[model samples]
Structure formats: C-alpha cells, structure tokens
Target: MTELTGYQHGLVLGKFYPPHAGHHHLVRTAKERCARLTVLVCAASVESVPLADRVRWMREVHPDVTVVGAVDDVPMDLGDPDIWDAHMAVFRSAVPERVDAVFSSEAYGAELGRRFGAASECVDPGRTAYPVSATAVRKDPVGCWEFLSPPVRAALTRRVVVVGAESTGTTTLARALAEHYRRRGGIWASTGCVPEYGREFSEEKLAELRRARPWAHWSEVTFGTDDFPLIAQRQNELEERAARLGSPVLFCDTDSFATTVWHERYLGGRNPRVEEIADRVDHQLWLLTDHTGVPFEDDGLRDGEELRPWMTDRFRAELTRTGRRFLTMSGPPATRLAAAVEAVDDLLGRGWDFAPPLPERR
Candidate 1:
C-alpha cells in the first residue's frame, strides 16, 4: 500500500441501512475535519436494503468521499469478540489505506480507532444534532422524509396505479398526473410515470411480425400466460427505474395486478409467477378508469373494444377480491384526469392516509 505524505485521512464506517440526514451530517462533519475521508458501507445479507443500493445512496450524497462496500454474509454482532474481529477484517480489507482518524457518531468508534492506531472522533454522539436513526427511518420512511435523499425517498414513495379497459384513457390520465406533479416543483419535481410496457412490447412485436408476413393482423398475435410474466416483470422494472430517477410518486399506467386480471381472462387463470409478482407489488391506490361513453378507436392491438365492460368488471373484481385500495373514475377524459389529480394530491397530502371512501370504488 502507498503511504500518503502529510495529508491526514479519516475513516467513517456504518451499515447506512439507508443513508439519511443524520448520516449525511456525520460524513460532512468528518470531511470538514480531515483532508480525506473514506466511508465504509458495511452490508450484511440479512439487511432489508441491498448492499448495492446502500452504496449508491452514500455515493450520491458524498461523491468525493471514498465510498466502498464492505459486503459480508457473516452476521453482525458487536457483542461477540469473534464477530467484531470478522467485521474489523472486513473493514480493513475494504480500505487498505492507513486511517489517520476514525469518525463516527457512536461509542464503537473508540474501539475501532484503537484497532487502526488512530484517534476516535465522535460527531453528535448524543444524537441531538440530527435526532434520527436508521431504525426510525425504516419504521416510517414518509414520516422521516424530510431527512432522506431523493433516491431513498423515491424508493419509499407510494405508487398509484391507473388501470382500465380499452378507450378508458389510462395512459392519458397517467401522463397528465405525472406532468402535473413534475411541474408542480418542490419534492414532487422527482415525480414521474411508468408507461405501459405491455403496449410497447406488443407494438414492437406487431412491426416485426408484419414485416415478415404481410397478412399478419394484430389479433393474429396469440398471447399465452408465459408472455404476461415477462410483461409484469418489465412493468415493475420500469417503475423502479423511474423511482431511482427521482420520481417519488410514480403514476403507473398499469401494474402486475391488472396484468393478472388480463391473464385470467385470456388464459383461463393467472400464471403462478404473475400472481406472485402481482401480490408483491405495493400499490397505494388503484385508479380504475370507467368506460363512460368514450368512443373506442381501432388501436390495431385492441380488438378489445367489445371486451371493455367485462375487462373493467374483471379489474374491479380482482381489486375487491384482494382487498386492495382503489378509486372508481367515470365521465369525460378531463373529468377523470381532474379526479385522479385530486385523489393523488389528497394521497400525498395526508402522507398516504387511506381511510377508505376517498373517491369511492365500485
């Protein structure tokens, strides 16, 4: 290892379960005191948040700090001597550079500093400075939203999924809500929407199939239960990607649950994997767009103009059956959009307080 000349290097280590304002302040404090700082993000397999995600959050806040992940499958136990030794080795390996000082906000810094032959500097040991903990943040992320960064906030944001049958304007309302929140500024500047992945995939398939066979029609494309699992997975992937991009409140065009409904209708029953994915997706609200006399245009893929009411009822039945929170929407596009915007605003306003009868679901 290369030895530095005169500059003093500091080491700050923590699980950073999800880096919050308290951790941010601790890192900033260390940076101000030392010429160079290296933050060791220790992650265990049993942690709720992934190691890669925690490292990303640390880097986002303190880019200049030498952020490194100390990933280990070993259980974390400060009480056991063997556990401490394993952790110390993990830390040392992560940062080979000689640590001139150890910075932390806990009593453990002293012992860790001794192992490195460095001074232990505790910042805000009393927790009075930031008055928060990782445990508190985990319990209620929204309650502690003010202290969290954009990436973390986005992860914790509640999703309001828009679902409907043909010509019910799910995409229109989704786009409108996304745009409104994004332009509204403040924390919502990070808000955006996940476009329907199923439609995009179908469009691509149509183009490719049509080029190969001139007689190919949209209805000719037979979709099986297997196709929907990929669709559901892709939809979630897009939603998660949007959230990382800073969209705290994502307006989803459709979610896995709605896809499951389609699966049941077309394939006789929902695929096991699709059902599992749907069950796992955490949606705060399901905005069901009603077919209120809207003229259905031939979208090529949608031979489902006749399938509107049936599909809509199927969607409603699924929501009701699963005991999921939902709101029923009817009227002109503008009216539906207005209602959706209002519901979302209320949803955000109350910090995701859903006491039912918000907009009334059929």
Candidate 2:
C-alpha cells in the first residue's frame, strides 16, 4: 500500500440534492487529504430528486472517491439527541467502516466528528469557491446553470423539436428560434440547434448512388425497413450531444419522433423499433409547421407537393395519439416566429418544480 500522510479514512456526508459545484469541491478536497474517502448521500423520500440519481452524479463527478446512498427519512434536528441518534443510525448503516476524519462545510461538522470519534476537517466553510447550494439550484437552475455538471444540464434542458412535411419551413423556424435565443446573450448565447440527421443520411445515400450510377435521380434512392431505426437512433444521439453542450433550451430542426412519421410515409407502415427509439428521449414541445400555402420546393431530395398535406395530417395524428405537447405554425414567416417565441417563453417561465425537502424539526 502507498504511504499515508493524512487521515486513513475520511467521510463526507450530505443530502447532495442535486450535487452542485460546492458539493464537488468538498469531495475533491476530502479526496486529496485522505487515503480513502467515502461520500454518504442521504436523501429523504419527500425530495423530488431520487437518491440513486444523486449517488450516480457524485460518482460520475468524482470517480476516485467511494460514493454510497441511503434513504434517510429522518427529519433533521441539530439540538435533539433523539433525532441525531436516528439520523446517525441511517448514516452508519450506509457506511459501516471506521471513519478517522469527518469533512464538511456545515455547522454540524464538529458534532458529527464527535459522534464518530474522528477529527473534524472543514474546507471553505465560507462558500467562497462555489457560492451555490441545493436550495439555490432548485429555485433557479438557469441562473446556476454554469455550476452544474453536463449530465445534470442534459437532464434539465428543455428540448423543442420542429417537425413538418417537405418544404414547410421547419428548418427555417428551428434556426430562427435558436438565433432568437442566442441573441439574448449570457447563458442563452450558447443555445444549440440540432439539424435533422435523417436529411443528412438521405443526402449521403443519394451521393453514394450518384458516385456509382452517375445517372441515378433522388427518387431512385431507396430506403429499407432497417434504415428508419438507424435514422431515429442517430437523431437522438445528435440531440443528446447538443443538449449537453448547449444552454437550458435546445431547438431541433427535426428529431427521432419525426423519423417515425417519415418511416410511415416511405415504407407505407409503422416501424416499432423506430417508435421505441423515439420514445427514449423526452422532448418538451413540438412545433408543427403547416403545409398550407407553403410552396413545396422539390429540393432534389423531396417527394412532391401532393404528399405535403398527407404528411402534415399524419404528424398531427401521431402527435395527438402519443399525447405529446405541440403547436401548429402557419401564416407569414414573422408571424410564425412570434408565436413560437411566445410558446417557448411560456414554457421557460413555468420553471422546474422541484418538491420542497422535509422541514427541519422544531
């Protein structure tokens, strides 16, 4: 074993409700000063965030340290010995090994060390490095977006996908929405727009056919039953990547959900595998661009003007059948953009409703 200079085994315990930068800093400090550190994530049943999610976030952020979680329903009371005993029982059950050092930034650190008969080590009790808490994060996640990890950001992001028939301005609207948000500056400047992967796949297929046949037209390129699933899967992957790197709101030209409709349009039936892939990721809103009066530009890869009305109705039907929230956009370009902005603003205004934690015992 390596020579030990500091505490043999250290312990850091907290609710870690959503695991912010402060929690990560504490874990990093504890890990640096001790040979082995165990982070005990105790969550109550009343909390909206699950214990398993908190444990996973901690483990992902700090892979070197040991992370464990336990359902701690016991109400908190610092002065009451009975409540302290009850809470300690839960903590001890999760971490049965001997603890030589107890690290924390809260006022209860000394008492916790005394109860464990270990040295109490405090790091940045002033919260100077990362001035953030679970309560603050829960209240305004957008304001605290920078302090969160990528996984947490991806989970919290509001994904909006624009779906419509050929030449219905879905791409234009998606790009406009992204630009509109990006102009807001600050966190919004990093707003992302995920383009349709299926479109790219189509272009690639056509290009390959042209390379071989040279005289083959876009209509000659064919799609198999298996192709729809791959398109849907790739669309989801692109959306996920953009969500992790972008701001709280992510706009998509089209998504996996739209791929299922395309599958029906081309293959003349439904693909269960494509539907399953679409169901994996959650999208907040779907803006359906109306094909009415919108000129269908063949774009070389498009099917024709006659199919637009059928495709639009199919998308609306499927969206309703699936119970996904959606809005239909029509009229001039400016009018459609204004309506879309209003809907998105309303969605953002609602905010994340994290259930309040159990109150401290009086």
Candidate 3:
C-alpha cells in the first residue's frame, strides 16, 4: 500500500509497542517531509498487548501515516542474528521491495535499508550510537523519564515504571500508575508493568543479548523516548514546523537502576566511571513500591513475589542518598502525583518568575 504521497515513497520499521510521543515525533516529521510514509509494525513481537494495540498507539500519535501490519509469519525464535540474513534472503517475500527512503532507529536498520536499495537515514534523536533502549524502558519506564520529553512522557501513560529489588511493588505500582493515568485520559506506554525489552527487533541483537549478555542483554534496549535521539526526533518534528521550539521535556521510565542491577548481578560490581556518565537526569521521582502488605509476582525477570518492604528500602536508601530531586510515591498514583505536582506548585506556584506550561507541538 505505497501510493498517494507528494514525494514518491518512504519506509519506517518499528515494534511501536504502545507507540509513544517520540514515535509520533519521528513519524509526523517523516510524513510531512516525505511523499508517503510506509510504516511496518513488527507483527510478531512478544508484547502482551495485541498487534492492534500497537497499531492503535501509532494511530493515537499520528493518524495520517499508513501503518502496515507484519505480512510474513515467522517462528518466535529470538536467538538468531542470522535471522536478519535469513529474513533478508526472503527479502521481497518477507516485507517490502520498493521505497525511495527508509527511516529507522538503529544503524543496522539504515544498513538494511541500503540492502533494500532505498535511501537510508537513521532517525535517532541522538546521533550517538548509544541510544535509550527499549530494554531500559521495559525495565523501569517511569523512572526513565529523565530521558524523555514532556509531550513524549505525557504520551507514555503506560510508562510508569516502579523499579527496585524483590517485593518493591514494581509491577503492581506500574500497573496501578498506568491505570491512574488512563483514568485521567492519557496514553500509558509500558512493558505491561513488567520488565522486558526489545519485544520487537531483528531477533539477531535480541538473541545475542539473551545469550552473550544473558544477565544484562536487555539493558541496552531503551524505548523510543529514553534518550537524546528520541528527544531529537521530537525536536525535529517541531523544528520542521517552526525551526525552534526550545527543548521538550521527555519522560524516561528507567535509568541506571536498570543498568546498575544488571552490572552488579552479572558483571561483578558497578563502576564509578560509568556511573559518572550515566547518572544524568533532572530528578529521580522514586517510589518505594515495597510496602508490607503488597504482593509481588515473578514475571520472568523479577523473582520478588512477597512484594514490597525490602526492595523499597534499598531503592529509597541508595537513590535518595544520591542527593537528587526525588519524591517517593507515598500513597496511590493519584496521591503521589498530587503531592509531586503540589510540590512543584509550592516551588513555582505564584512566582511571576514561572512561565505557563509550554504549548504542545502541533
């Protein structure tokens, strides 16, 4: 379904799991700039949400672009980088053939576009090879907001990540917060309140992560909103419209807590040097999900079932001690947000120094 565009054609590939503001940023920018936007949604991703939900997320952000559902049916085997080779072999039989431009989030994606004989350009907001990964997002989505923009964060109603060790109510909190936001009429992007990443990709990198990294393979995969590239995508979307829209506040769901956990568990210990570079963000917004009565389940990644109490203690002690602007989500999501917002109100409340909340991108 590639026709009726002002230019000639365009192609974009992504899992678009509960697509966030960053996804919309890139797509809307590409759509307006290109002739036609051909979107390929990874049909076989391991997300709990349906393909329709993924598509629906895209629609929520950008209604104009044409989103194509996965056409080729393949096995769910992820430990196969050779899959790209095999899938590429299927080539025309697998996805699409004709396109003038291809947009992607990875360097490899651009390389694949070149193989498809299309003009390839990477769409990451950060030009750096290290991007905010989907894996990071799945680990702890809300805490990762430091990596996202305000609009993007707003769109990530599903991205309220509650991170910590065993019994911290990470899953329960994620779900509860997600529900709270939805009741308030916002889109919540998340890994279904559990920790998983790269649910949709070439299966090659995913497989490699599963094998070689095993304990930390999923650490590298950040969501579309977790890094500079995602934010840059947001900027360009507006830049194309007006050139300078200032910096957008993107909300990240997780951060070093995710990486730190992986490193400590598998790699022996955390590094001060890496922490220096990784400890980047404006606030922590920590929530001690571990209360006495909360129940936790071992959702593949986490093994904390008697959720709450212990995990909460650790997260609060370490993260809070970091000397950052962190406020624990004390009660329910609504109550926590209210307290946080009110705290902001106290700080910026009646100050003539404050500016109104920025107008959203058109």
Candidate 4:
C-alpha cells in the first residue's frame, strides 16, 4: 500500500444534486492531495434526484474515494448557528472520522472547516475550471450537455423509438428524425440513430447459411424462441451505448419493445424473457409507421407482405396495452416524416420536469 501523504483524512461534502463536471473536478483535486478522502453527499427529502443515485454516481466517477450519503433536511441558513449545528449533526453522523482537511468550491468552506477543526481548502471557488452548477443543469440540461457524464446522459437522454411492419418506413423515419435534429446544428449536430440490430443479426444468419449451402434462401433461416431474447438484449445494449454518446434526443429504428411483437409474429406466442428484456429500458415516444398506402418491396429478408396489417394491429395493441405514448403515422412519406418531427419537437418543448430542490434561507 502507498504511504499516507498531505492530509490524514480529508472531506468533501455537497448536495451533488446531479454530480456535474465541477463537482467531479473538486473531488479529483482533493483525492490527489489527500491519502484518504471521504465525500459526503448530503441530499434533502424534497430533491428530485435520489440520495442513493447521487451516491452511486459519485462512486462510479471517483472509485478511489470513500463516498457516503446522508439526508440533511435541516434548512440552510449560513448566519444561524443553531441551523449550522443541526446540519453538522447530520454530516457528523455520516462521517465520524477525523477530517484533517475540508475541500470545497463554495463560500461555506471556511465555516465548514472551522466547525470541523480542520483546514479549509477551496478549489476553483469562482467556477473558472468548469462554469457549471447543479441549478444551471436542472434548468437546462441540453444547454449544459457537454459537462455531463455518460451515466447522467443516459438517464436524461430522450429516447424515441420507431416501430412498424416490414418496410413501412420505420428505418426511413428514424433516420429522417435524426437528420432533422442534426440540421439544427450546435449540440444537436451529434444526434444519433440506432439501427435495428435484429436486421443485422438476420443478415448475418442468412450469410452463414449461404456459406454452408449456397442454395439456402432467406426463408430457410429459422428463428428459435431463444433468439428473440438475444435480439432484444443486443438492441437494448446498442440503444444504451448510442444514448451515452449521442445528443439530447436519441432516435431508434426499432427497440427491444418492438422485438417482442416480432417474436409473436414469427413464433405465435409471447416469450416472457423477451417481454422482461423489453421492460428494462424506457422510451419517451413510439412512432408506429402505418402500413397503409405504402408498398412493401420484398428485400429477400422480408416475407411478411400479407402479415402487414396484422403486425401493425399487433404493434398498436401492445403499445396501447402497455400504456406507451405513441402516434401512428400514415399518408405519404413526407406527411409521415412531418408528423413524426412535430411530435418529437413537442416532446422536446416540454422540458425535463425536474422537481425543485428545497428552498434555502436567504
């Protein structure tokens, strides 16, 4: 083990409402200067983000430090000694060990250190390194998307999935939606569209069969009951990966939820495993591309022209049964795209409704 250096046991405490880049920098600075650092994440009962989530995010970003959480419902009043004492009780209960140093970027660092009988070390008190705060993040996450980590981004990204029968413009609409967002430029320039993994899997299976027996056709490739679960899992994994790296809004050609419907269309029954996998992820909106008036061109892999109406109805039934917010797009290609874009714009207009934090005493 490495020998102790600088302060014996340092401390950093904050609400960590969403754990922004500024908070991360402060913790990293303290960790390098102290042998053992304890980060106390103090959250109130009224905060939107959960205390456990904040603790988990902090631990994920800074694994070297000891991260703990405490419910500090005591009202904030820097001038009141009794309030400070009450808040300190909560902090002390969470961290009873000796604190040689208290690191912070807020004005309360001096008083906090004095009360704990430790040196107060302020890092970037002026927010020069990263001009971001939890308040700013809560108000407009898209404006401050650059400062967020992947886990937070994944949690906040608005996922929009497009599902429909074969060749009904699901892929076309998904790509068009992503392109429309990208045309907005700025932060929206990095908008992503996750292609259907199931399609790729099908293509690979056909290719493999062709190598073994060149006479094998697309219809010859059979799907086992277990294959749907794998498809759903991979589709979810792809969606998550794209969400972590993409813009505020992520578009999916088809998601795990759509996989369940396809499983029923192929195998004639519900697979509990596929349904369970579908329920794991959350999608904000579903655009069901209606098969009416659209011609289904047989792409070798697709053999479900007659099953188009049945599949469309199944999608609508499942979407409604599961209480999912969705819109069925019909008419010409341009009309469908326009309606889809309008729905997405409306979804974005309704800003993330983050519950306000507890009011602080002025």
Candidate 5:
C-alpha cells in the first residue's frame, strides 16, 4: 500500500499463464521494497505457457530478482480444499529460505505468507492500478500485444508456411513473400524464412554417404527411412529460433507436414515422430504450390520428376483429410507470388491492429 518498504526478503507467487503488465508491476513493487525478492512462476502441465518459457520471461524482465520455475501437477480448482497442500509443497520447494514478506494482489497472499512465517502485504488488491490480467492476455494474446514481452509476442505470432512437392518452387515462393513483407515496412518490415532444413540435411547426407560407400544408394539405406524424423526435428527447432528473433511474421519454406507427406510417399508409410511434430507446429496458412506445367529442373537431388504429380496428389489428399486451411497456387512465378501475397495480405488485414475488449469478470 504505502510504498511497500521495510522488508528484508520478499516473495511473490503467480501462474504467469502469460505474464502481463500487472504481474510486472507486482514483481517490480516487491523488488523495490525488499533486499532480496523471489518471484515463483508456478506452472501446471495444462497451462498455455510452459514453465521454462515463463521462467525465461521473468528472468529477462527482472534480471535482479530471483525467479523460480515450479511445476505443480496437482489440480488447480481453488474451491477444492485438497489443493492447498500441493501448492504449499511446490512453494516450499521453490522458496526454501525464510522470507520476511509476501506481496501479491490476491487474498491468497496472507495464507501463503503464513506458511513461510512472513508478513503479508497486498499491492493493488482491487486491480485498480494495473487493469490487465493473465486471463485477458491468454484469451486474445495478439490483441493484448502491448502488455506482453517480446518472447511472448514471438510465441503468439502466426507463421505462414509455403509447402509442396519437390521442384514446386517452395523455396522461391517462400523467399519472395518474405522479401515482399520485408519491403512493405511495418512490424513485419524484417521478415525471415525458415529455410528447408530437410533439404540441407539431405544434401549433407547425400555427400557423406556417397563419399563413404560409392556402391550404396541413399534410397536403399537407412537414410531414406530414418532421417526424416531428425530433419523435422531440426526444422521445428529452427522455426522456433526464428520466431524468437522477434519478426512479426515468418514465411517458412516448408513445414514438418510436408516432410510427412514426403515420408509417406518415399518411405512407404509414415514416420510417427514427423507426424507428432506436424501436429504441434501450427502453421497459420498453408500455401500449396501447384505442379501444373512447372518444368522440373534437375537439382542434383531430385529423381522424382515422374512422381511429381503423384506427390502433388498425395499432398492434396493429406491436406483435405487433415482439414487444414490452404490455397493452391498455379501458373508462372509471378502469378503464384501474386496469389500468395493476396492470401497473406488478407490474413494480415483481418488480424492486424486488434485491441481486445476488456474481459468480463467471471
């Protein structure tokens, strides 16, 4: 209340489901009042924000304050009296040292303080000082962008992936759109592409295998069947890293779904790992390149010219079966680029500049 001072060690506990400005205010208030401040980020398995990501945000925002990431599997129904002990156990594990004060804007602060033998203080208990909450942020993260950190915004930013069969200009179209967004100038003025990590991996493996065993064909070896999962894994990792770089939008050359399509066609079945990663990588839009009359240029790695149409059919069938949103682009590079640009622009136009209305109280 009155400047919140005179405490040696202060503690603050929160879900930080997706940290908003109000949480920032509470932590900063505690940090100013105490000699040492500990902000525990307690996350459940079902929470939208992962425990590691929340810890990263807290540490980045308040580098001086000690931040603890606690994982609690116990159910989170406040009405259930059984949850308190589970919560207390998690708190004790994180904040082991004796605390002098506990600061929070919720009534639970008093009870939490009692468990630590610390005095309790409420800061902005009525939510008048800062009008944001984690619930409001989660319901409409892009709309509540102003209150979120860069890492959180990066996580929320939608990635549009351009994918298709081999020799269908996936890289060309992806790079073109990325450059177009870069030149358009806005929050998306510096867009980046998650280049096909699979292609890179394939080229490397091709050279390595050829050098090691001249008689061995890549198609006959484990490289054909076993390498896709690793490629998909690396591709996902690169996409996440690109997102963390803070570009408002990412134009991915290809996605793990495309890799699964290739796996189904080449390896005779599906790689379960690739399928699992495909489910997790959320591409806002899929721009499937049409194989209509686009002459297949022999790029050292492609022996699938005859299989081009078949692969295209495979991609179309899978997209339809999975119920994914996609637009097929055919014609010359210019025509395809124009169509892709229009679709992406429509997505941007619809999603841009949204300010979520204040959430209704439960």
Candidate 6:
C-alpha cells in the first residue's frame, strides 16, 4: 500500500450484480487521475453464493482491481445504522487510508468525506454515459446484467489466476500472461498472488532463529496453518463469484492448494484440501523455479532465502502428491515467463474462446 495524495483516489460503490457502461466510464476516469482506485461492492449477502457472484462479476469488469472483503471486520447488515457506520469504518480502515479524494454517487458520500476530512465528489454518470443502474436492471434481469460495461462484460467472461510460491515468477508471469491474453481482447487481469505471512514475524531474535522445525504451528488453527487461510478464503471468494454469475471464474495465486502442499510436506503426507483441489480445479498450472540463480531479496514481506528450499520442496511435493502436473521453468526469468505464456495458450486453446480483454492503461 502507498500513500495517497494530489487528489487521485476515489471510492466507487455499487452491488454490481450486473455492471454496465456508466460504471465503466467512472472507473476509467478515476483511474486516469489516481495511480490506483478501490471499488466497494455492496454485497446482498455473505452466503457463499452471493459473495462469489459479486466477486466473479467484479473480476470480469474490473480485472485489475484488488478485490477484497468489505464485511470482514463489520456486520453485513445494510439496515443496521450502527452496523452501517461500522461497515464504513471497516472499509476506511482497510482502504489505503491516505487517499487524495473520494468518488461516489450516493448523496451522503460527499458529506461523509467532509466529516472524515477527505476531499470528495460525486461523478455524475448520468451526464457522462448511459446511466442505467441496478434498479432498472433488477426490473429486467436478463436485459440489464446482459448489457454491462465493456470492462465489466469482459471481466465476467472467464478468469485466469496464476499460483506459485515466493521468488517464483507467479506475479511476473501473471502480468505477462494477462497482457498476452488482453491482446486477444476479451477481459483479463494478472491478479497478483497473496503475500506470505511468515515474513510478518517482527521479533528480531525469534525472527532470526527461523523457528525450529516450523512444523509445530502448522496444524494450529490460531497459528497460521502450513496451509494458509488466505488460499481457502481466496477460493471461497472466487467460488462465490462463479456461482453468482452462474459462470466459470478463475483466480490466481491461490492459498489453500499452496498451503496443502506445505502442510503435507511438513507432516510427510497429504492434506485433504490439496486432493479436493486437484480435480476440483477447472485447470491448474504450477510453475517450478529454482531460486538458486536468483539472490534472496526481501520485497517487504519475503525476508530470506534460507527457507526457499523448504518452501520449494513443499510446493513440488504437493503437486506430486495430488498427481497434479506443473510446468517447470528453470532458467532466466524471461525464459520462464515465455514458457508460461505458451503453456497458458495451450490450456486456453483446449476450450477458451481467447478473447483479448479491454485495452489496459498505457
């Protein structure tokens, strides 16, 4: 997360049960002024199906936005005033606190920003483009959800998420492949994988020690799992999105599978989640990279490479235990990315229509 300044940040809110053109222009304009934009989707429920639907719909339209949970720290009750205030607080807390400005359509948002000491404005979609909204869409579900913003419609088609461990080129390959998919033009985004929690240990002495065995806490629910919750949560969210739109949705940088791998290797066995995911997944492409050539570099959370071998082995073993075959790219970074692009092409060719997504910001 970076500091927000110079009036470039804005908050776009909506259920997005079905995205449309007006939503597109507003997001597009906001991105132009802000280095980053955050979208706050109003979910109708927390049940897996509804949540998944929203996430999937959003993924289709705003492919690059860092989609996150809004109800996590607050109640999802739309009618509860205390809960409503709490909801705003939760989003405000999770949101990049330092934003230059806020974007909204609701009347209260302007006043809300003023009370909070943020510069805010309501961008009038009615004046700029087709202003059809959820109300009209609800009145006609088939017609409305069908006609969505180019970005939104494109975002909804199908998703591609790349998964791997730290130092592996998941992020790099994700972006490259995303762009490669975009050239074919439908909707695609290289969603970056989640950050590792191990790096968060701030105890200088304990951190330096690297935790003897590191397996003790692997099964502790309180302690982060050998199979991290982020992966499960990520899957849970994506599944909800797919179920919501009644369409196939994809997410990259999964946690549970990656977690299952680590836990199995640590415990010298398999985690059931890994087994379920192998056949459960529509497709899985694992990138095997030897961190030997790459020097240990801590990008904020990734602290050291002493454990790189341990992490790599767990990922590999998990792939094997599940009988999941992966693509191994052992060489320079560029070579790996090239191979990944080709492999993805082969996979998508199996059934993907392969439409180039909307044009990304230059």
Clashes of each: 1, 0, 40, 0, 0, 26
lDDT (C-alpha) at residue 241 in model 1: 77
**Scored by CA lDDT, what does every candidate get?**
0.81, 0.93, 0.47, 0.93, 0.80, 0.52
lDDT string for model 2 (19-88, tens) is 8899999999988889999999999999988899899888988999999999999889999999999999
Better of 1 and 4 by lDDT: 4
Badly placed stretches (over 4 Å) of model 1 are 5-17, 21-101, 105-118, 122-151, 352-362
* lDDT of model 4, residue 209: 100
lDDT of 4: 0.93
List the lowest-lDDT window of 10 residues for candidate 2.
Answer: 1-10
Which of the predicted structures, 2 or 5, would earn the higher lDDT when compared with the native? 2
The better-scoring model by lDDT among 1 and 6 is 1
lDDT tens digits by residue: candidate 5, 1-67:
2345678889999888888788999999888899889999887775556789889988988999999
The stretch of ten residues in a row with the least summed lDDT in candidate 6 is: 353-362
Per-candidate TM equals 0.70, 0.95, 0.37, 0.95, 0.70, 0.41
Query: For model 4, how does the per-residue alpha-carbon lDDT over 229-258 read when each residue is reduced to its tens digit?
Result: 999999999999999898999999999999
- Candidate 5 residues lying further than 4 Å off, grouped into runs, are 1-6, 13-17, 20-29, 32-36, 40-147, 210-224, 350-362
Q: Candidate 3's residue-wise lDDT over 217-269, tens digit each?
A: 44464332223333323322332222111111112334444434433433455
Q: Estimate the TM-score for candidate 4.
A: 0.95
User: Which model is ahead, 3 or 4, in terms of lDDT?
Assistant: 4
Q: Rank order by lDDT, top first?
A: 4, 2, 1, 5, 6, 3
Candidate whose TM-score is highest: 2
lDDT by residue for model 6 over 1-362, one digit each (tens)? 23453454556655555556666666666665566677766554432225455656566667766455454424344345676576567667657456555676655566557645677767783544565775564444334544554334334333444555566666666556545554553323322233333223223224444466443321232323434344454564554344344222233444346656555434556556545553444444556665657666555344435777777776676568767657666677788778777776665455433222222122
